[model samples]
Target: MTSSLRERRRQHLRDEILAAAQALIAERGYAAMSMEELAAQVGISKPTLYSHFSAKEELVIAMATQAMERLFAVVDDGDPPRRSALERLADLLRTGVQVQMDRQVTAMHLWMPEIVQMMKSRDESLTQLCRIDAVVVDLVRQAHLHGEIAAGLDESVVVRIFYALFMSPNVARLSLVNSPDPETMPDAVAHFFLRGVAAGKA
Candidate 1:
């Protein structure tokens, strides 16, 4: 095949493999998934699957990276003047939680141990994560400087606390069991955080 054709074929195959893996993860938890089953589901040979992803860990990392990219895109597209930075930050957190509740997202997180191991071995993915973390931290800091957050609050601590709130098991449990509307969760989190951080409120 021509180089262009080869590249297109490769892209198509990768998409198929990712789709199959996501479906499998949704049907059966990530722990139960297997590369062989994924290859079969993608209608590709094991060797072909290996060519695309080498191992299950690489595939999961790619999936997570894709999800994070989507999340950042959402945050980037947010309207700023209409909403405070804190509101935008809350929106980002809510987006992260909703992504986690998603089957593909859950699969990625469920497979995170192996993913972290892979990052340890390769070392590149951690850099990407750090870059993303820095951006998030900066956003929080800017919010405080802009008076969107109280002056006395520690930006770093507030950012960490915001993340913790999203990752809290109670929030995840509420998301999974109650199936609370995704749109509502952000507002709720923002309200709670804002009240605590409001200027002159204490």
Candidate 2:
């Protein structure tokens, strides 16, 4: 069914608000982002912003939830034995990194203690995150079975480490050399992580 004209306009504004929120949260940590600032940045009144999102936490949760929904849709599961577990894992990592780059924020931002705490109360956001983690856990197990990951590394630890690598932008900032080009960061990061956890490397 087609959306009514008013509904379409409302959704367009909602998308605009979420895009602004992503950039603001990327520039300032979520703890520092304010609804008032977001409203002003979007050229909307506070009441207008509040009309779409009831609260700051709700808005942030909506943004993060949308992100996870996109990630869930695009990540390949490497079904039917077409790819090695290692290959599949690398693809997943690259997709995730590329997503953060596109959004100008990292998953690490969403995993911050305060954000995580806030998200616990948002069932849809929490569920989407769990779904992503579940896929990662399965991939890690498959990698281990295929002798791709280093022997004896705990699956949970590997999974956590995989998530931690999403913070590569912070690490890149501290580098003496120039940061990895955004175009190559996905492959560079995926290679770095996979090599670190390779069967004989760990």
Candidate 3:
């Protein structure tokens, strides 16, 4: 009973900390939110926060992993039979991107530098990212096989190309210039992926 109570309290604290961090990120930019401030916002001591997450970077990584898991769930839960693989893939990508843009883009941008560093330093995170890439690649390959995408198209090339187009311009804009025009990004990316890379019909 004691152990179970401790575990419940631990989970509660962790959830509170995450909630505080997210609220702070929404209010101020991610760069501006400090660990001390986060702890205070959560009504926890600094050491308590540290007990849950060793550092800000680790906390951010955990947050990002949670976000990715949610995205994967969205993709997995999508209708497969009713929709063509191409349509399903497009819907998944479009919906996933839009959800991130709406829900977590600011946090993502704020943590990107640290996340990139984490990816380099942590093999597990790198592996997870690769697995996510493989899922997208498989979708492309299946689409081609089913004739939903053009025959003879290189799936690997298409996956990489689409990944680049989806992540680059929006992320760059969020970092360098300003927040992206959210209205157009999803449709634009879906159309680009569904259509040929060249200027042609989708």
Give the runs in model 1 whose Cα sits over 4 Å from its true position: 75-84, 104-121, 168-171, 174-177, 195-202
Say which candidate scores most in lDDT. 2
Q: What ordering of candidates by lDDT runs from best to worst? A: 2, 1, 3
What would the per-residue lDDT of candidate 1 be over residues 1-202, giving only the tens digit for each residue? 7999999989988988887887887788677999999988878889989999998778777777766776778566765546766766777776666666564345335335566566656556677567667767877877888887777788878877876766642345546475555656656665676677656565
Q: Candidate order by TM-score, highest to lowest? A: 2, 1, 3
- Looking at candidate 3, the ten consecutive residues that score lowest on lDDT are 103-112
User: In model 3, what lDDT does residue 82 have?
Assistant: 75
Model 2, residue 163: what's the lDDT? 80
Q: What lDDT would candidate 1 get against the real structure?
A: 0.70
lDDT of 2 by residue, 31-54 (tens): 788999999999999999999998
List TM-scores for all candidates, in order.
Answer: 0.78, 0.80, 0.75
Best by TM-score: 2
**lDDT for residue 133 in candidate 3, whole number 0-100:** 73
Model 3: per-residue Cα lDDT over 1-202, one tens digit each: 6999999989888878877787788789777999999988888888888889888777666676765675578567755567666776777677656756665545455335656677657677777677777777777777777667665567777777766665654465556666667788778778877776322354
Question: What lDDT score goes with residue 49 in model 3?
Answer: 85
Which segments of model 2 are wrong by more than 4 Å? 1-3, 26-33, 76-81, 105-108, 171-180, 200-202
The residue ranges of model 3 lying beyond 4 angstroms of the native Cα positions read 1-6, 78-82, 104-114, 151-153, 172-188, 196-202
